[model samples]
Target chain A: MRDNGAMQHSARRDDTAAQPSRMQSAVFLPIGDEGRAELVERRIAEAITGGLIPAGERLPSESALARSLRVAPVTVREALVALRDRGLIVTRRGRNGGSFVADSADPAQFTAKRLGAMSRVALRDLGAHYSAITRACVGLAAARADASEVARIRQRLANADAADEKAWRRAADEAQTEIAALSQSARLTREQMRLQAEFSPFLGLIGQDASAREQQRRAVLAVLDALERGDADAAASAVDAFVRDSVALLIDHQMRLHRA
Target chain B: MKALQATDAPAAVDTVTAFFQRGVDALGEGTRELAADVASARAEGPLTRAKLDAIVLPYAQALFDRAGVTVYGAGFIAAIGLLNDASGHLSWWQGPRHSKLELAAQNIGKEHIDYSELEWYRVPVSTGKPHIAGPHVDYLCSDEYTITVAYPVFVGGEFIGVHGMDVLLDAVEGELLPLLSGETEEITVINAVGRVLVSTNPHRATGDPVRDAGDTLTRYECEGLPLAVLVS
Candidate 1:
């Protein structure tokens, strides 16, 4: 006897509902102390950039976070305050109130002064590091990922390209993470997320320019195309070029600001 | 008595497999989080092998508890320093139990114990899969009969190293010994290579070669492991 599609459809619906909470636990838990407050704050910030914690989501309460993290309640409070100051979070005072991720109404902006203050050496080193990691990850993804995994990555890349300016920063960050996950190594994915978090505040500066945004999309698409074809060499080269070009542009912009 | 022992084998196999599977999953998750810590540590400046090991130390404890193994070690292919924890459990070579750090320091000077060449670490890095490496002597950690489980740990898509767990063969024997009590006829557990790992018969010891009984002995393979239950 043939059953209706209701059972299968409902099963999928249940999965969709369960996914965010699972992602929340996976992203948030297992946070070891590298200076508890700083690490926790950085992780939460990275989760936001990686799209693990969506905008407008309410954060766990301070005590609850403290209990789960095995940190003093005051430590979570301090980190939350720092996040609020950075405009990454907002706090509500009412009875039904808690900390919430800031709405994606405006992208966080980095000024020319901030860019110029960073030494050329530091900027170059950061870019070189990311280039090394991401290239290796993309190559492995090309060699290992099946068609369906490639499709998921392509979809994320497309979402980033289509996003509005305010949401594009996070969307692009997530696209990089999605590609890393296709490498099928949890370690690679974590490294990608960490590198993205480290550079995202600076990368937001370039997102304001439409031409720059288009260039990024094209660069990612090239990598995507190579991965879909299962060409590891091409995939590595495309990722290398993409990261190299972005670093070059950022350095050029920094030099211009310094000259001005 | 023979019937009771027969019924117990399947249940015991299920319990053991589930235990180790959960351990593998937990260790994998812990090591991924450790990789993130390593990346962040790099953001501050370049990290040396010892510094990297230091960053890994706190996270290594969970691998021991979760895997239900006697000791857990994470060794890099290129690094000189290895991060490991055994919860201060001493091996047969020690006079009194010492800290894992002391044990590691004692073992570090030996030229014979090359982690790079060990099958437990090497096989997983080459194949990028979890592997079982012993039922032989673990010269470095326990100096007793041990079995090792090694899982490849990759960061940035590079095969950086392996995460390994060493379970004392005696400890495994302790866990399996109780089930052997009810059997009347000779019942033995054998490794993949036909060596007796555990036996209900008092005279037959572990690590001894199983004597050929030809058609008299029937062997059943355990699920998800290279082990067999033998009946006569």
Candidate 2:
């Protein structure tokens, strides 16, 4: 009877793929030895713009952030002040208060600036990193997930209209993440989600074009088709191409946006 | 000699049973305390998230501390049907020094799954009995091979959810290996799902299905739990 309302998450059976701490992904990753407050500010700013930390979401306590990022509490404090000045994060003092990403964040507002600032080399590197993780996740999903699971996610993806980029991005993100979960490795799924949060904002800027959104929709569907067929290589390759195409498109868009 | 072995078997199984029962009762005590808090607080007014967290978080922390190394993960999976939020309200916490689980969180790129299908959540809610589930990979939470002991939480007659602890497979083997030692013949312990918990046979392996034993083994069911000691 319980199965009547059951989620189709049983695809994670390979047993070799356990992985991620929710907080430790991108936001909690250690900063460099530079020890500069600006670097700390920039690191957290990327997480916010990337939407890894959602608007109104409370950040780790100053001490907690300091310990995880391996920076001094004063450095973290300095970064928070800068983030507040930039209107990226806000601090409230109370029993429940801590730093929170400002609710006014439109994601696109922060992402445009972030995308323009990145060198094409850094952009390609980001895409390659995301694709490598996605390839593994899709390959595992193909080997472990049932056709029904893939079909359920495909149905969600198929229903999202490319014209409505926001809704499409939301559906696309949910679809890809659910498919990644089929890898049954908590770490892979966690990284996949983190990368999506970190990468989707750029995709959002690029996806503003109708053609770009349509192209991405087709690529996602192709990957799903291969996954449903239980062809791991086919599924993995489809995702690689999907990511390759988006990254290339994003690089072009960035150059075009800032044309001299 | 046969009569002596028959009595010895029950005594041996009882020791293993008592060991698991003590852990179950520890988790159950917290469930009852939280359920009482919820029921009484609801009697006064509406269920606020702050109030719920105040009731649930302490119990979660205590369960984590009290169970110590035995429990790798601990918390409450609120029956959203009772709580009336399809999105879910989970107060689960896990270790390597306490992190909240996002299995039920609604985030971009993250889907909130209906956990009712999972045996650990399903059995206790359906049977209204405490249950011991798995030696399987926990994709939803710990991402480890886990043996989950769950006690159903009920507020008056309404089922609130489950208060539970996850013992990692390594720790489970640690607890079971000594209890299962010195057997005259090969023996395997399997969970409710028939996944081997521990076995003396090198080839059988933990998580091997009991059905694969191929009629060569004799199965003795552990009293009240979905566990068995199989001798071949």
Candidate 3:
């Protein structure tokens, strides 16, 4: 009877282990380059957030991750790098130490530092640079943008128009970045993304007036219309004009505050 | 002695006119060569840094020589391939004239003359049209102005560039006006669009809209003139 009980207990433990392992495998089926990295990092982060991988729980070895995911060790490394950048995982060198979820992470510090950097940059100069780049992108987009790209831009613009000031600013940032990406110039897109990151904090500080924001929405729509019409020159001009006007408004407001 | 001096004045005038005509002719030839050189050079790609320098330095030197005439300044187009893409390269150059030309043009659109102001479109050597010296003349000469010449560089009937020169009233007032036998007529050379390209009178000069009203004096003169010479 005792031997029978021992067998039953061992079988129950095996079943308990098999269920989560199977669920995890199902949750993370690595696909392509970006998809694989995203899946691993997302799974790891969610596990930590949900206390599934509790603080101080050592993550699986890189080799083990590779074996389980049927992906290369390099992908595991990339996913770890992303999680490290986010401050969710800490790695140490020693016999006992591997990667472990951090016990505490302060999101407030991350946000404050990001915002403070933005506040220091002059909005007017940012506007000018933004204008120059976006104009170039719009011109290029008119020539090369595919149907899916057009739909994405239209969707972003709609989101921007319907959003409140804060939401609009964020949506505007994404839309501009998307437009730059549509140009298919990696260098241009990288530079624009950097600019957007630099501007984010100050964008949160200043509120765009409703009328001006509405006008900007209209201008973006006009650009989309030009794109739809397949008028490259007009699209370029419209984008350039919108950038100039938006920059002017930002500069005017900043100057007024300075004078007062 | 009186007859000798009178004859000398007409002879001097003829000589000056001949010299100007020769300079204009030489400019035309040089411009054609430059355009051909530009087209060939830009065919493969934009003129390289060394080649662009090679072209512009000599062209600018020639422009400065022409500006040395009674006219205060001259500017020409220099095409450089700055933007290159799948569509190939587009290149052009403009003016190497006085730096103040930019400042003077900027003063026109404003209510008050802001001395510190600088306008990008006004820059003397800037590639865009309504070249600086033309606008400068318009600001300085009013409705009583006359004679603005924009000698554009054409190669094979296409306007590849321009060499703008103006003869304003102020420059002529102290010297040439007294010599004319008839009443001093206001001759304004306007571009096809009616923007005063150049004028002898200071008031009708800079930034003033072209008046196409019933007034025959300023009724868009010079329709028959070459489009290359008209300033608007």
Name the best candidate (by DockQ). 2
Best by lDDT: 2
1 against 2, candidate with superior DockQ: 2
Give model 2's DockQ, 2 decimals. Answer: 0.08
Estimate, for each residue in A77-96, the C-alpha lDDT of model 3 and write its tens digit.
Answer: 99999999988999999987
Residue A92 displacement (Å), model 3: 33
Better of 2 and 3 by TM-score: 2
Using lDDT as the yardstick, the better of models 1 and 3 is 1
Fraction of native Cα contacts reproduced by each candidate: 0.00, 0.04, 0.00
lDDT of 3 at A121: 46
Residue-level lDDT of model 2, residues A1-260, one tens digit each, is: 66533322322332344653454245335556764798888778876787656689877678767755667999989999999999998889998888889999767767877788889999999999999999998887776665656776776677777777777777777777777766755678778877877778888788888888888788888988898887989988898888888888887878877993
Model 1 misplaced regions, further than 4 Å:
A1-59, A81-90, A100-107, A111-113, A159-163, B1-232
Ranking by DockQ: 2, 1, 3
TM-score per prediction, in order, is 0.44, 0.66, 0.31
Cα misplacement distance, residue B84 of candidate 3 (Å):
7.8
Better of 1 and 3 by DockQ: 1
lDDT of 2: 0.73
Model 1 Cα lDDT, one tens digit per residue, A125-178: 988888888887787777655565467557655655444764666567656766
Better of 2 and 3 by DockQ: 2
Q: Report how far off residue A174 is in candidate 2 (Å).
A: 4.1
Report candidate 3's fraction of native contacts. Answer: 0.00
